[model samples]
Target: MTAELDTPILDNHLHLDPDHGRGIDAVEDFARAGGTHLLVVNKPSWMLEDVGDDEAVFRAVFETTIDAVERASEVLPGRAWPVLGVHPALISKLTGRGYTPPEARDIMQAGLDVAAEYVADGPALALKSGRPHYDVGDPIWEASNDVMKHAFELGAETGSAVQLHTESGQDFTEVAEWAEERGLPAKRVVKHYSEGRLDGPTASVLADRDELEIAAEEAEPFLMETDFIDDPDRPGAVLGPKTVPRRVEWMREEGYDDAIRTAHVETPAAVYGIDLEATL
Candidate 1:
């Protein structure tokens, strides 16, 4: 199953938000449209909305992520995978900004508990926070390390994959270095789109690293995204499964076979340790 024309390719990184019309059904439709596999992210917006504001909402968001993954596992079996994410900003939202204390510790511990449960489930747990604060380089960042390591440990225990998101290009390299320095057991580190870098530069950065994974989208091969926003007024409002194929062709034209090859979908099955061979 090489990534030839009409071959079933896995979309290694796809956002699955029900609010944005990207979820199991959208994934299935994508698969039917030629995508053989999809890694659906399970970070619900409610995870942010409920924090500090409403404990019930926060719990409900976490529950929704778990339930969504469970349902996806049952539905796709080997096709859909889920990547659970914990945003660092959530802590401030839950505990209030710069207001640390014994109670803050309690709140963080509670958050960690929820994080640990998701990690234990074997889905690819993604740390969606940025550098220094969340970078594995600083000692203060050790907290982030602890969170990632805990997730990695759980992945090691269950033979699942752990994915890390580096929002900055420099931090992306820092993450790869941190993984090497600490001997973290993560198999894949995903470099989310560096805010404003061009595709060529981003590809160059990713190409330099062997341990990191890059998620390529159809239009933006450097930035992996799948959810089609519902705003008809937007210029790219008609994006869909066709986007993947176009990106693949664009990369081919640019002689980016390596980048194209590294691209794979993040599916619930992959997160849960299903051993389906990579089809592309």
Candidate 2:
């Protein structure tokens, strides 16, 4: 079913790696369903075990995404933006498989360096760095925060927006403080897939229609995301990439036209500096 929305959507986060044959379908489907723009990211978690060589793993992840973005640019045009970075949970995932903290940090640095390259060029929209796995004991934060701080430093250096993935947005307060100390603009720091109280640039709660309304009322600068995982096997693991468009269609249906325009059009442009007018 093709969605014809009054306002086109810009999904803030989605993983569109190469092994993901489903990704092509997601791009086509999302566009067909009214997604005009996407921030395509690399999900290091999916390939962590398959590609045992840690350094090579990050390379493959970022390179595959850069290439995918290049290709999507042909079809989706300038709407396909790259989001390259190391997932904070990769360290813990590798450590569980017997890698030491230093070993993990070394591998993480390798991925982050690749991300820094694109960020410096300013083509890649943002660097995704955050605490994904939350069940670990308190001590794990020492190493995780170390990796996160480095990612944040890269953001500060490049002036690229840092889109964070957190346990439940609890770490963002501390992370935001960390970004401030390093001289990164608060307006360039974003919280990914979080609804908790965090002061920063953009925050996506993955809201439903009602929650979207509440979020709009609560914060003028808020955003929406699906966190789509483009995984072939799980089949809509978190939420489909087109979910945001569908939500926007409902917003239009419910006569929240003004709010829909703000979320799908205005906020994305103002927050990320992405000009969707070109896609039109």
User: By lDDT, who's the top model here?
Assistant: 2
State the lDDT at 37 in candidate 1: 54
lDDT of 1 at 269: 31
Worst 10 residues of 2 by lDDT: 45-54
How much does candidate 1 score in TM-score? Answer: 0.58
* TM-scores, each model vs. reference: 0.58, 0.88
lDDT of each: 0.43, 0.71
Q: Candidate 2, residues 1-280: lDDT per residue as tens digits? A: 5446445677788877556557677787777777777888877744622433355666666777877877766666336888888777777777887888777776776678778888787668788877655777555666677777788788878877788777664335566778778877666777777662345546766756666777656645667778877667777757886788787777666767777667667777766677676565
For all predictions, the C-alpha RMSD in Å is 7.3, 2.6
| Candidate 1 Cα outliers beyond 4 Å, as residue runs | 1-7, 19-25, 44-49, 52-59, 66-78, 95-112, 119-160, 171-174, 180-183, 194-242, 252-259, 265-280
Error of 2 at 250 (Å): 1.1
Query: Candidate 1, residues 69-169: lDDT per residue as tens digits?
Result: 55545544245555554554444443345544334334444554554565565453432322233423343344444555444444344444444543344
